[model samples]
Target: MDPYIRIEHLTRTYVRGTNEIHALNDVSVEIADGEFVALMGPSGSGKTTLLNIVAGIDHATSGAVSIGDQDVLAMSDARKAAWRTRNVGYVFQFYNLMPMLTAYENVELPLLVLPLTRAQRREHAQAALEAVSILTRRDHYPKQLSGGEQQRVAIARAIVTDAKVLVADEPTGNLDAESEQEIMTLLKRLNKELGKTMLMVTHDSAAAAFADRTIRLEKGRLNTKTPETAGA
Candidate 1:
């Protein structure tokens, strides 16, 4: 099968004064459809940078990134934005839910970009919330729910668009251990049952265990680590 995501000689550099910082260097990888992959590394290892590039939130200084068959790096900004809305879902470390909006409303926000009517958006949002098993908290505000509940709502919002790929950055970073387990379980379900391609950046080893493959990076280069059991 064709890879769902592909990167070729990807390099991202940031110029600070006379110094150039390479966030990624000649990095190339592929993620198959429905694959659960974890990006693991120390701080400033370029894991998040890779995620942003793949999600089209940021561009690489050199090289190419292709999602399925479309060359993401080659698209115009406007086209990239539209493609992201239709094909990518993002989950952040901090639940980026709008404080003023209720859980249901937050999930419905992404659908606004689509041609769907308000009623259709509501149905999709509600279904997403239900899929995450958080429909009961739909009427609650972010602050009104527990940390786990809030993250669940965020996941629901991410999936509301039915994006083919889900990119999560430290999704369990802010939750307690119990809540972390809950979030991991939900992500695992999304990959296994829903067949959503998932690429996650996480610091927690237990959390990385949920993925099928784990990749470690160091100083912007893919670290050479012997493959071990997922949780080992």
Candidate 2:
């Protein structure tokens, strides 16, 4: 089968003063549908850059990025934004939940951009909360929940749009050990059970262990390795 996501010769560069820095250097990788993969590297090693490119939030300096048969790198900014709303779900190191909104309302935000009615949006949001096993707390505000519960709500928000791919950057960076384990277990279930393709960038090997494979980067180059070989 073809890769669900393909990135070829991906390069990203930035100019500061007279110096040019390469954030990603001809990086090539493929992620299969329903597979869970982790990306690890030192700070400034292009992990987040690659994720942003895959999520269509940042443009590549040069390369080909295809998800399924769609050419992501070729899309216009407006097109990318539209595609992202439908195809991509992003989770940050920090849970980016709206503090004042209830968990259900926060999950409803993405569906508001679509043509769905208020009743439809509420149904979808409630189902998403159920998927993440947080439906009981749907009416709670972010501040009322614990760190783990907040992350679950954030995950529910990401999946409320029924996005096929989930890109997470340092998702467990702010959680306690127990909470981190809880989140990783939840992510693994999402990938293995719900068939959501996952690409996660994390510094923690224990967190990466939840993925089916682990790929490393150094100096902006792919250092591909299997989970067994990588000690994940």
Candidate 3:
């Protein structure tokens, strides 16, 4: 079967005065449907940059990215934005929840852009919250929820759009050990049971262990060792 996501020689660079910084250098990867992969690296390793490019939030300077059959790099800005809303769901380290919105409202926000009726959106949002086992807390505001609950709500929001690919950046960064485990279990469930492709960037070794495969980066380039070889 064709990979659900593909990156070919992806490179991203930023220029500050005369100095050029390479955020991603010839990074190529392929993720099959329902696979859960972890991106591991220290700061400035370009894991987040790769996620951003894959999510269509940032463009690579050179190379190509394809989500299923669509060439992401070739898409027009408007098309990319629209495609992202439909195909990609993003979970950030900071949660990025709307402060004023209740958990239900936060998850419902994404549906507003779609053609779904209010009742449909509500139904979907509630189901998403339930999937995370936080349906009862939907009425609470972000500030009122614990870190783990807020993260669960964030995950609910990400999936409420029915996105096929979930791109998470340091998703467990702010949570405690138990909460982190809960989040990881939820992510695994999404990949295994829900059939969503997940690409996660994380610094935690235990968290990375949850992935089926782990890719490490150094100086913006893919490391030579595959996870199996590294273990050997």
Say which candidate scores most in lDDT: 1
lDDT, candidate 3, 192-214, per-residue tens: 88999999999998888888888
Deviation from native of the Cα of residue 229 in model 3, angstroms: 6.5
TM-score ranking from best candidate downward: 1, 3, 2
Q: Looking at model 2, which ten-residue stretch has the lowest summed lDDT?
A: 223-232
Model 2, 1-232: lDDT tens per residue? 4689999999999889999999999999998998898899899999999999999999899999999888999999998888898899999888999998999899999998899999999889999999989999989999999999999999998898889999999999999999999999999888878899999999998998888888888889887553333323
Off by over 4 Å in 3: 226-232
TM-score of each: 0.97, 0.95, 0.96
**Model 2 misplaced stretches (Cα beyond 4 Å):** 224-232
- Supply candidate 3's per-residue lDDT for 183: 95
> Could you give the C-alpha RMSD of every candidate to the true structure, in order shown?
1.3, 1.7, 1.8
Where model 1 places Cα greater than 4 Å from the true spot, the runs are: 228-232
Model 1 TM-score, 2 decimals: 0.97
Q: What is the lDDT of candidate 1?
A: 0.92
Candidate with the greatest TM-score versus the true structure:
1
